[model samples]
Target: MAAKRILIVDDDADIREATQICLEITGEWEVLMAEDGVEGLAIAQLEKPDAILLDMMLPGMDGLTILKKLREQVETQTIPIVILTATAQPNERKNFDQLKVAAVITKPYDPMTISDQIMSVLLTSR
Candidate 1:
C-alpha cells in the first residue's frame, strides 16, 4: 500500500513538530504541516491529502472556520478531518457532532498513538 499522506494544522510549533516526527517516524507516513488555517487551506487544496488532523484553536481562522471552508470546497470536502481539541466540553462536543467530523482527538494525545487514533477513525469512516 502507498504511504498515507496526512496534513496537520496547528499554530503551536512544538506540537506541530512533535506530531510530524511521531507520525512520520512511527507510522511511516507522509506528513504536511501548516501553522495556520490559511496555509492549511492552501495546502489542502493543492495536495488533497488523505486525512487532516486539525487543531481546534488556531491564531487566525480557528478549526471550525477552517472546517467550514474546507467543507464548502469540492476539492477538499470529502477528506476525513479529525479535530484535535484540548477538551471535549459539552457545548463543543455538540458543535463537533453537528459538524460531523471524522473524529475528535483530544489534545495532549500520545504521540505514539496519534497515528493509530487517526487511522482508526478514517478507516471506519471509509
Candidate 2:
C-alpha cells in the first residue's frame, strides 16, 4: 500500500511540528500542515489526503465550520476527519460527536502513540 497522507490543520507551530515529526517517525506517512482553516480547506481539496487532523479552534474559521464546509463539498465529503483539540470537555465532545467527527483527540498527546491512535480511527472506520 502507498504511504498514507495526513493533513494537519492547526495554528500552533509547536503542535504542528511535533505531530508532523511523530507521524513521520512512527507511520512514515506523508504529512502536510496548515496554519488555519482557509489554508486547511484549500489543502484538503487540493491534496486530498487520506485523512485529516483538524484543530478545533482557528483564527478565521473554526474546525466545526471547516468540517461543515468540507462535508458540503463532494471532493472532501468522505474523507475521515479527526479533531485535534486542547480540551475535550464533555459538552464539547458531545457537540463534536454530533458533527460526526471520527474522534476528538485532546492536546498534550503522547507523540509515540499518536500514529497508532489516528490509524486505529481510520482502520476502524473502514
Highest lDDT scorer: 1
Model 2: per-residue Cα lDDT at residue 71: 90
State the weakest 10-residue window (summed lDDT) of model 2.
Answer: 92-101
Backbone clash total, candidate 2: 0
Residue-by-residue lDDT tens digits, candidate 1, 49-69:
999999989997989999989
The residue pairs in collision within model 1 are none
Displacement of residue 4 (Cα, Å) in model 1 is 0.8
- Measured over all alpha carbons after superposition, the RMSD of each candidate to the real structure, in angstroms, is 1.0, 1.2
lDDT score for residue 96 of model 2: 70
How far off is residue 24 in model 1, in Å?
0.9
Cα-based lDDT at residue 80, candidate 1: 93
- Which candidate leads in TM-score? 1
Can you give the TM-score per candidate against the true fold?
0.95, 0.93
Model 1 TM-score on a 0 to 1 scale: 0.95
